[model samples]
Target: MPSKFGFIYHEDFLKYNFGKGHPLNSIRIQMHKELLELNSFFNNPNIKLISTKPCSDEDLLTVHTRDYIEFIRKLSETGVGSVDDKDTPAFKNMFEIAKTAVGGTITAVDEVMNGSILHAWNPGGGFHHAKQDSGGGFCIFNDIAIAIKRLIKKYNLQRILYLDIDAHHGNGVQEIFYDDSRVFKISLHESGETLYPHSGFEDETGIGDGEGYNINIPLPIGTFDEAYIHIIYQILPLIAEFYNPQFIVLAAGADAHFLDPLSHLQLTSTTYIRIAELVHGLSHKYCGGKCVLLGAGGYSLNATPRIWSLIVSKIAEVELKDEIPVEWRSKYNEYFNENNAPIRVVDDNPPKIDPERYKKISKYVDEITNRVKENIFMLYGFFKLIK
Candidate 1:
């Protein structure tokens, strides 16, 4: 029997490379794939492997402007100019890579909608910072928005929940959906006050009919594993209670790991698995285990693969003991001398928590969960009063 657990991955996705020193380089994707193949969960009878073609111009236009699409096309053909903030230089084929990424996401959404899969993972998609007409944060297309457009048009799913945990805010996604009442965009990220592509503020919930539908839980620097769990513990139930979405998407970024060079969040491998478990529980409870996972930001090659391996293990219902693979580290050694990449799945064997950091994070946990409880009560009263 075909399974609802499917994966959308491609060798060609590696062509979307951002060059040396860039965090969004192709190696991250490659390393993640390598680690995934090392596990047998994907070979399970219930897991299906699939791939998708590039999105057509019409599909791309679902969330992007024609002019912006044209600009990318011309630049892609010419292989000239910079599509990202000077930091993300575009060589030839940048357009194809970005389009294919978006196509991969839509294909996953299409499969999920058609019941071809109960859950899907798109390693090349989730470029969440791109807007309708422009690129930002190394994201060339808002593939998330593209997927949402199709889900709404084809399936009429009125209540969609989007949860992002990238180190950076998903500004483009929030901007596109901020006005629509049918979709809710919630992000847990480094405070935009300190991060790049800054936007996800607490007060920026959806407006008009969509008011109070969106949520953002910005965190301070040095936020550790326990603290993030507290945030997710608080936000997930509260959001579930309030919006009641039948469809959900999570931007599972690995950059929040304590080892990542780009961000300050000190989340560990074990914590990531817990988050995946949370998502699994939420989907099972609210949407019959119907949710799609999008690969987002993660720069540390050494740390990123283990984080994803843990996630894939949960998604595919595989149980992995706390042991790292040897071949995996050998591969990492070939690619990285001492810098980004790592040979083993997770360094330090087991991730450790500084006693002081845990204490601080614990404080934040209490604050966020308590605040959310207050709002939930207030909303309960307001709705009951209106009734």
Candidate 2:
């Protein structure tokens, strides 16, 4: 009998840190782990707390180029210079730390597939922005891609669904599997026009055998929970049903929250729960709950932990008190020095978007959703052309 859920963690995950004042802080991961512990979420018999180890160069070679792997190794030795140009700053032992992060996800996939656990979440994984030969968006290794490749190789599974909701598009993963039909990739992000790595346009659907397997939904600025959830609820289930994936990999980035400094989307905690619920349902419905989730991107020290906690609670079917634990709050204050630590597990209300602004956003979302239906959904025979 498999446990209901597994949460992967490692103290070395904190070493994946970039530097002071960097947006991709590792402390949030620690805060989330401590929060769950303080809340007694781990005491449940159905939940398992799993330790992680580092992946080898051979494992990384499954998705990255050999020359690029050597480059990261040499850069890690120097402990100076960035991985690409600016975003990914290299540090001593960075290659080793990144390999550990990738290993966390791989272990999660193995655990789920081998029936040790029904589902798993690797807080250190989800480096979707890392390309084959270079890094970007603070991502050093494309762990999501590597894990997917490992799934196909080890389990002989086809029809894997890679869903990314990081405020930024998953350009690196899309680029790697752009022409491959075995993977169906969907990214819902803040429009690339106003964000970094300016791509993920609606028309960037896949080509050749991969045509229509790639889906991108670029939301305009000021997108609130109503519009955000509406798009997800409308599109995700239909695609999952049609794809009937044998495994699911989710890049559940918390940066889409309204409190996050990195993106313009205004999602509250409710939307995160809704997403977890939908994904949990889809996994059981399509893949025997063989799913691995990765914490891809989220910058808000205050909101990110709570958002992740909520998602984890939902997945484990564990109920939590709304109040933040006093001991955890003390630790948070000491680490972050911010007075505005979240007081509750969930946000009280969704932010209000200006009516006119929301109207424009709704129109744009409809257009994008309709375009996806016509382009991607039609390819799966989920939509029909009307004359």
Best by TM-score: 2
Candidate 1 wrong stretches, greater than 4 Å: 1-3, 337-361
Cα lDDT of model 2 by residue, 1-387, tens digit: 333899998888999988887888899999998888888989989899999899988899999999999999999998899898777888899999999999999899989888889989999999988998989798999989999999888889889999998999999999999998789999999999999879998888899888888999988888888788888898888888788899889999999999889898999998999999999889889998888999999998888899899988888888878999988887778545456667788997668778899889898888777777766557866434452
Model 1 TM-score on a 0 to 1 scale: 0.93
Which pairs clash in model 2?
Answer: none
Give each model a TM-score.
0.93, 0.96
Best-matching candidate per lDDT: 2
* Residue pairs in clash, model 1: 4-118, 329-343, 329-344
lDDT of 1 at 244: 80
- Kindly list the per-residue Cα lDDT of model 1 for residues 323-347, writing each as its tens digit: 5567776666755655444544544
Clashes of each: 3, 0
